[model samples]
Target chain A: MTLGRLNHVGVATPSIEKSIPIYRDLLGATKIHEAFDLPAQGVRVCFVDTPNSQIELIEPLGETSPILKFLEKNPLGGQHHVCFEVPDIHAAKAEMEAKGAKVLGEPRIGAHGTPVIFVHPKDMGGVLVELMEAPKREH
Target chain B: MTLGRLNHVGVATPSIEKSIPIYRDLLGATKIHEAFDLPAQGVRVCFVDTPNSQIELIEPLGETSPILKFLEKNPLGGQHHVCFEVPDIHAAKAEMEAKGAKVLGEPRIGAHGTPVIFVHPKDMGGVLVELMEAPKREH
Candidate 1:
């Protein structure tokens, strides 16, 4: 059970700028990473780090983006996933699959280039979850 | 900046037994705590601990509970709140208020007799976050 610490909670919002102040000012988080046009995921993201865990705010880049659909249904926004830091994302995925849980994302590059995967919400009783192996910290 | 770590992520579900196997076997979580008929909150809760963070499954006791309303709005269950392990919940609440965040619970006793306060989602950009303070052993 050499799991790492939980890295972050991913949130899907319509705009990052609108969400930043709540995290930075209210939660005492600071902007640590930012990226845009993730063509693969069809969203732009910004990561804010508090003393405890990171907060990832994502905004859809196009009308066709899955995030756009999510926002349409949940205009007020909803949590995307509660991510847990794991030692080996690949191994975790394998173990989860063996237990009959549906795995969504395979071990793959995620925000900030960390290896990550998702356990289906249905399997977890309706909470989307992500497992990530910490990537190299960047300044 | 010694803030607390994320203690757990709460989720409102329709059933706890159905959700256990996924969390325990698939997500590698172990059942650490269980509380039933919390009249104060009108829900039954089960705490599942992973190596890094805990997962709380909440089941509404009746249709009168607020969680029941949340489920009615979004049939698909979702993440509820990010619970942070703080050192002084009062200090955390005062700081949050000073920074213009609305306090929900206002430093009250929570699930495990820990002093806790909830920052309103309206103040957190759609993320319901709880600040908890009380010395407790890590699982």
Candidate 2:
């Protein structure tokens, strides 16, 4: 599977509204998407784009959320994942699993109607990585 | 100061040799440089390069090394820093510091003679970031 580009960097924080301004002023990113109450994911996320890459700010909605638990000790912040744009998510997952890498989730529909798969950190030397195939734009 | 491109992603590991094959096979990167004794920093490092970016695998040299201490609890793997290429390292540091980001180090020589400085995670939402400027090439 061909890796296209570095898609985005994921960061887990305490609050998006508080963090957005800092990132915007420093990185010059514009907020492209914002959503709340993603109960299944247990967090609210805002997608901000810069010229070269995108930044994902995730804030936990409930106490039980993994990100919430992560923040208990590291209240300052945490690196979530480094996503890579792949031409084919399924093909990439298959290749990774074949090479003794564990696939965290099977390819499924993710935000923005794109097919994405998460690879476990255990397989990738402790860095959680995501492989995504962008959605086709309809005319 | 404008961010040029991402230079390298630093990954702290227990053993650079153990982790090299995985990155090589998965990311299509080839070994470019290896330093077994960084007495100044108390660690060993191997640089792997891909077409667009590089990955730095660092392992502590002795028990007293900070990386060795860090690996004790986070043995699975984790990011050390995400460095961005800049035209001027000191200028970038000054700009980031003026914006309230804590500069970890003054611009100094790092791998390949590149002048670099680190920004503390406190200001970057827990992600250790480095600013780097290219070295002059000799004939």
**The candidate that achieves the highest DockQ relative to the unseen native structure:** 1
- lDDT of candidate 1 over A1-139, digit per residue (tens): 3435667788888888888766665665544566566767677888877655677788888777867877887676768887777777778888778878788856877776778888887776777778887675679
Candidate 1 residue B16 Cα shift, in angstroms, is 2.1
Residue A130, candidate 1: alpha-carbon lDDT: 80
Specify the CAPRI tier of model 1.
acceptable
> Once superposed on the true structure, which residue ranges of model 1 sit more than 4 Å away at CA?
A1-4, A35-37, A134-139, B1-3, B134-139
Residue A21 of model 2: what lDDT? 66
TM-score of each: 0.83, 0.82
Report DockQ per prediction, comma-separated: 0.44, 0.36
Question: What overall lDDT goes with each candidate model?
Answer: 0.74, 0.72
Look at candidate 2 and tell me the lDDT of residue A12: 85
Give fnat, all candidates. 0.46, 0.31
For candidate 1, write residues B15-101 as lDDT tens digits: 776666666556555445664666677778888776556678888886688689877865666688877777788888888888777
* Interface RMSD score of each model: 3.2, 2.8
